[model samples]
Structure formats: C-alpha cells, structure tokens
Target: MLKGKRILVAGAGGLLGCKLCADVLSAGALVVAADINLAAMDERLQQHGIASDDARVARVSLDLSDSSSVEQFFCSLTDLDGAVNCTYPRNKRYGAKFQDVTLADFNENVSLHLGSSFLFMQQCAKYFISNQRPFSLVNISSIYGVVAPKFEIYENTPMTMPVEYAAIKSALLHLSKYVASFMSDSRFRSNCVSPGGIKDGQPEEFLQNYRSYCLGKGMLDISDVVGSIIFLLSDHARYINGQNIVIDDGFIL
Candidate 1:
C-alpha cells in the first residue's frame, strides 16, 4: 500500500515502533527509523531482522522533547511522504496510580508526552505548508482515549491506566483534528489510530478480564495495529482526514 513512499516511524526503539518499521518496509516504503536512542533503535530493528545498513532503512536519533531537535530533523528532510508518531514519552513516575500521582509528576508527564506530540504535529504541518507537498501524519492514541477505563480489568494487576495517559491521549485525538482542520488541504491530512490493550506480558488474570470486554481477541499484538496506520499513510486513504480508526476488537463497543 505504501510502495515508493518515504515514511518516518518515530519512537522506533519501542516495540510497536520497531514492528511498524518492518511492516511498512514490507509494504515497500523506505523506513526512517527514529528514536532518542539511535543505537537502541538500530538494535531493536536488527532484532526484527532489519539490517542496520538495509537499503530501505535509515536510522536517526530524535528527541521529541527538544524543539531544536524536532525542527532540525524536519528541516533536514527533503521528501518525507508521511509519518507515524509512536513515541510514548514519560517521566520516571509516569505510571503511578491516581491517588499516588503527585501534581508535579502529573504536570511533567503531560508536558513530556502531550507537549512533544504538539511539537511533532506542528512541525509536520509546517513542513507540508512550506514545501507545498502532500503529507499524511498518523498519531497513535489509545482505546482509553475513546472511552472510560475498565477499572475492573486492572483490579488484580498493578496497572491503573495512568491519569496522565488518559489526559494526553484524549487530547491527542482532538489535536489531530485541530491540525487537520488547520491545514485545510486534502493533500495535507492528519489522522489518529487508537488501539486497545496490546499484549505485552501482562498477567493472565488481567488478560482474561480484558478479554471479557472484547470480541474474541483479548489483546492486540503490535502487528494488528500497523495495517490501519499503513492505510492512513497510503494514497488509498487520500481523502481520509481528521478521522480516528479504533482497532480494539469491539472493546469500546
């Protein structure tokens, strides 16, 4: 679907990010794997059998939190067709429970994740406007952003869906819409993909609880979420803008 495209996969060191690079590469796009840790991102890509010197892969370091870094990276680009932001930025105390979360930590986490998202989205739009080229940007949100958390599912688990995450992701959906509208050109579009809980070694009890709310697939794998992203980035979705595609196996239903 993305043949001949040059796509940027931010946060390429992450599990989802790395897998996304491989998937898009298989679809024939030149994958620019970016992360704050260049070495780590390269290592992760290698784990997925993407050679460091792969002809279709280019690895770069990106720290979304730094304005200069983001600007420099985007300015350095010449023909970026699309980008998927899979970066999940957080401080050390990011996942604390609601009650345990201090106001300081809350602000910091929000600034780290949401602020960086704003920066990246703004840069993408600016790049398109300046170059007058067609561009697609896919921001990764979450099912929790669409609906309230199923607190029951996380009961026995040590996870409580961090309050910061809820705030950041929910805001991101609206942010994408805002950018899409602000851009106002069909060729320059922004969209979002909100995936349900992705399996990442959570306890079975929690998985069972999660499954009860889903339609068969208890939790998604990284692969399950990439197709929608690839579609949004492809010309197949040329007219699709400011839309949110939920891939949660009916979890929010």
Candidate 2:
C-alpha cells in the first residue's frame, strides 16, 4: 500500500505502464505519468476515466533521451518517493538476426531501453541522496535478457529481436545492482523486474505457437508481473535491493 507517496512512472502510456499508474493511484499514491507522446497519455487517461481535476494524476510530456528534459522534470518534482522505468521504443518493423540488425535500430533501442533508464536513475539517486530520503526504483526488463528464446517472438509484429535490447536490459540489471551497492549505506534502493511474454492481440497462429511453446516451457501474462513490482516499490520490500526478480511462470527455469 503506497498512500500519499509521490511516484513517477516513465513511459506511462504503454499497456503495462498504464496499468501500473492506475493501480498506484488506486493505492492512494500521487502519480506523475511521463511519456514522449502527450496525446497517447491523454487518450489513456481519458479511457481510464480520470478527470482533469484529479490532483492525484498529472500527465507530463517527457523525452527521456533528452538529459536536460529529464533533469528538469525531476527537479520540478517536490517529493519523489519512487520511480518506475518502463520506457520502450516502438518495437514495430525491426526484427532481424544480429548480423542483419541496422545501426539505427540498435541505437534506437539502446537509447530508450538503456540510456533513458540510466539518466532517470542517476537523477533520482542524486536527489534521494542529497535530500536524505529513502527512495526505490523499479526498472522493467524482459525475460529474454536472461534467457534467449528459441524463436523470435517480435518478428511478425512491429517488435523485433535486436542485440541492443537484450544487451541494454542485461546492463540495466547490473546497473540496478551497482546503484544499490553504491548506495548501500543510504536509503536509496534499485531493482529490476523481468517479465515474460505478454499477450496483446498477436496473430492467432503466433499466439497459439507462443502459448504452446511457453506451456511446454512456462510463461505468464502481464498481470503476473505486477505483484513483484508492487512489492519492490512498496515499504514491504524496503530491505530488498540490487536484485533482479524474474516473473515468467518458470519460463527461465
């Protein structure tokens, strides 16, 4: 239960990010939803039926790749108790072998998945350290970062298998650990959540294949991952830090 806490969620327009924001708000937390596309955020908020006067929810237009913008955003916040890094690049039209991966594709994924997360965490850490406040950061990663899938799931969809995504996610986990270690004496904490395959209107054939494969292995939906995030961000996980919790229904097993 995060009541009266100030929480910032980057990439708040995405499916998971939207769910997280709504849940956090329902839990009585003040949420700052930051996204590159304000229109998308507006649409999402409207769909959620959140009114303009809802002081508990604020939509901010943020370009995470821009360092000055990120700094300004964080500086504007009065009390940042927690942050969730869920920003991801458009995964459409970009699946290929490592050798076939283009520089642009690689850079785009890296900038969003890795660069943005690093910048946000760095800013949050500085603020928390200087203000002597106990804060937590939950970074969203993928199960693929830990275990390579036999088949490329993002191929047919706008999503793709890029070396940069995997590399950056792996790096994010380590970065969380490093931040945790550096602030071991402080109240600042950082951790990662690696979710498994998320089903969201994929082709029926593809969905069947994915479900069968994952069933043979083990996979779960987006809801399965929310609990871990809630725990990591809540006071319940105050002592937990520098850890990567995988919630993939034993797919990695």
Candidate 3:
C-alpha cells in the first residue's frame, strides 16, 4: 500500500522500530532508518537477516535531542512522504510516585519524547508547505498517557516510574493535534498511536503478570503496530487527522 513512498522512521534501533522498518519495506516503501546508535541498528539489521544490499532501506545517525542534528537529518531528505515518531527514552522503569521523581528525569523524558517530536514535526510541516506535497506523521504514545499504570510493579524492580513520562506523552498528543490544526489547509495529517503494554522481548514472568492483570487483553507483538502505522501513512487515511488510535487489545476498556 506504500509503494513509491519515502518514509522516515525515528528510533530505528529499538525493537518496535526494527519491526516497523521491515513492515514498511515489505509494503514497497523506501525507508530511511534514523537512530542515535548506528552500530546497534546495524547489528539489529544483521540479526534480523535483512541484507545491507536491500534497496528499500537506508540508515542515518540521528540525535533527536539536538536541534542541529534534527535539522541536518531532515535537510538531507529530498522527498519525504511520511514520518513515524517512535523515539522514546531508554528506561523502562514503570513504577514511581510523582513526588519521588527528580527534575532531571522529567527534563530528560520531555526532551526525548516531546521536544524532539516537536522539532521534527515543525521541520516536516515546513517542507510540505513549501514543496506543496502531502505528508503524514504518526506519533507513538503509551497507554500510560491516557491512563496511569499500576505502581505496584515498581516496588520489586530497581527502576522507578516517573509521572513525567506520562505527562510528556500527553503533551505529545496535544502537540500532534496542534500541528494537525495548523496544517488543516494543507494536505498534511498528524495523528497518534497509543499502544498498550507491548510484549516484545519481555520475560515470561513479566508477560504472564501483565497478561493476568490485563485479562482478555490480547498480547501484541511489534508487528501488530505496523499495520496501523501503514494505514496512517498511506493515502487510505487521507481523511483521518488529529486523531489518537489506541491499540491495546481492548485493555483500556
């Protein structure tokens, strides 16, 4: 469905990013995989058995936190049809009270999730407006953005969940909506995908616990997010704009 399209995927080194890249390539789209860790991405590509000779894939080193880096990356693109913002902070600690969260943690999360996305969206919108080309953006958000997760999980782990992560994600959602409204006159669409706890490479016990808590909540592989992403990027979602699609196997219900 994405034939002839050029798509840029942020966070291409991570688990979900890898799966999304493969899916977009399989759909006949040209992909530019951008990540901060180029070596990690190369290793992942090799592990996944995707050949370097594949014409559909390209890799670029991108540091989203740096404005200059973000500008340089987007400036190098000649034609961009769509972008997927899957970039996230490296930590996965999911339990902490808001009062216990540090200022550094809050700033870091905002920089990675909200600030970087805002810069990219601004640049892309400018490109679309100036070039008069239609484009789409798919921002990846967490279910925690909509509703808080159980804090009990953090009690056993070394990681501490900060309320800032959730706050930044919610901010990203609003950012998407604001961008969508700003581009309402143009052929640009911005939306969000909020997925429930994805079970990519998680331990059996953790998965089991999550599954038990979220009974009837179908476990989603990274591949499950690809279809929704593809739909959002394609002309098929031409009329869909400023909407947040939650993919959590009905867990939110």
Candidate 4:
C-alpha cells in the first residue's frame, strides 16, 4: 500500500522502531530512520533478513530533546510523505515506582518527547502546506493511555508502570486528535496507535505475570504493531483521521 512512499521514522534505533522501518522497507517504501544517533544494529536489521546497507533505508541523526535538532531534521528533508514518532524518551527516573515518581523527571521526559512530537507536527504541516502535498503524521501511544495501569500485574515484580508515560501518552492522543481535526485538508491527517505491552527482555517471572493478563495474544512482538502503523500511513486509510487505533489484545479491558 505504501510503495515508493518516503517515511521518516523517529526513534528508529529502538526495537519497535527498527521493526517498523523494516516492514516499511519491505513494502517498497523509502525509510529515513532517525534517532538521537544512527545506532540501529546491523545484526538486528539482518535478523529480519534485511541488510543494513539496503538502498531503501537511510539512517539520519536526530535528538528529540532539542527543538533545533527537530526543526533542522525536518527542514533538511523535502521527500517525506509521512512521519512516525515511536520515541519512548526516558532517563534515570523513568521506571520508578509511582510513589517515587518525581515532578522533575516526569516534566523533563514529557517536555522532551512531547516537544519533539510537537515540532515534528509543526514542520510536517509546514512542509505539506508549502509543498501542497498530502501528508500523514502518526504518534505512538500506549494502551496505558486508554486505561489506567493495572497495578496488580506488577505485584511481586520489579516493574511499575511509569507514571510519566501515562501522562505523556494520553496527552499525545489528544494532540494527534487536535491536529487531525485542526488541519484544513483531510489528506493531511494525524492519528495515534496505542499498543499493549510488547515483549522485550523482561524477566521470566515478569513475563509470566504479564502474559497471564492478556486475552488473546499473550505478549506482543515488535512486528505486531507494524500493520496498524502501515495502514494509518498508507492511502488506504485516507478515511481514517483524528482516531486512536488500539492494538492491545484486550489487555486494556
């Protein structure tokens, strides 16, 4: 559906971001994978049978915390048909317990990621408007944004859902919705995708505990969310705007 489309994937070095980039490339789209550093591992990309130097993929440097960097990245590009923000900005206090959550870390993290998303949207709007091109923007949110964290699942585990994430992600949905509605052209749409817990390198006990809470898919692979993202970015979903497509396996229920 996205053949020849040029997609900019922010936070492209991370696990979920890399998977999305790979999928986009497989669909015959050009990928401008940007992150704080172009640290996407060759082994990781090749794990999916995609080579690191594939002609379709271009790696760029980006830092979400800096507005100048965000603006510079967008200004440097003229071929972006769509952009996706899959950034999960964190620091020392990210996974801290709810009680231990501090205002400083929360605000800092939110400001950086949210600021990046904002600048991305602004530049995207400018680019689309000035170029008279139809464009799409996708913000990666979490199922926790839809519903509160089920504290019970983390019991006996060292995990506690970051309070800052909840605040930031929920705000992201509203931001996307506003942009979708706020835009003049329906073609320049903004939407969000909220996925459930993606299986990473969590402890075995934590994994077991987490798996028991799901309805169908016990835990998500990074690839699970790619379809939803591709759909939203492609022209096939032109009718979809100002919407939040949740990819959780009833975990939020």
The candidate that wins on TM-score is 1
Per-candidate TM equals 0.99, 0.89, 0.90, 0.94
lDDT of 4 by residue, 94-193 (tens): 7888788788987887887777678777878877877777788888999988999888778788888888888888888998887877786887989999
Q: Count clashing residue pairs per candidate.
A: 0, 3, 1, 0
| C-alpha local distance difference test of each model | 0.93, 0.79, 0.80, 0.82
Note the residue pairs that clash in candidate 2.
91-158, 91-159, 92-158
Model 4 pairs in collision: none
Task: Report lDDT (Cα) of residue 83, candidate 4.
Answer: 89
The sequence of per-residue lDDT tens digits that candidate 2 reaches over residues 69-155 is: 888888888777899988886445355678887888877777766887889889989888777778989998888778776565444
Q: Where does model 4 exceed 4 Å of error? A: 41-43
In terms of lDDT, which candidate is strongest? Answer: 1
lDDT of 3: 0.80
TM-score quality measure for candidate 4: 0.94
lDDT string for model 1 (189-228, tens) is: 8999999999999999999999999989989998899999
User: Candidate 4, after superposition: displacement of residue 194 in Å?
Assistant: 0.4
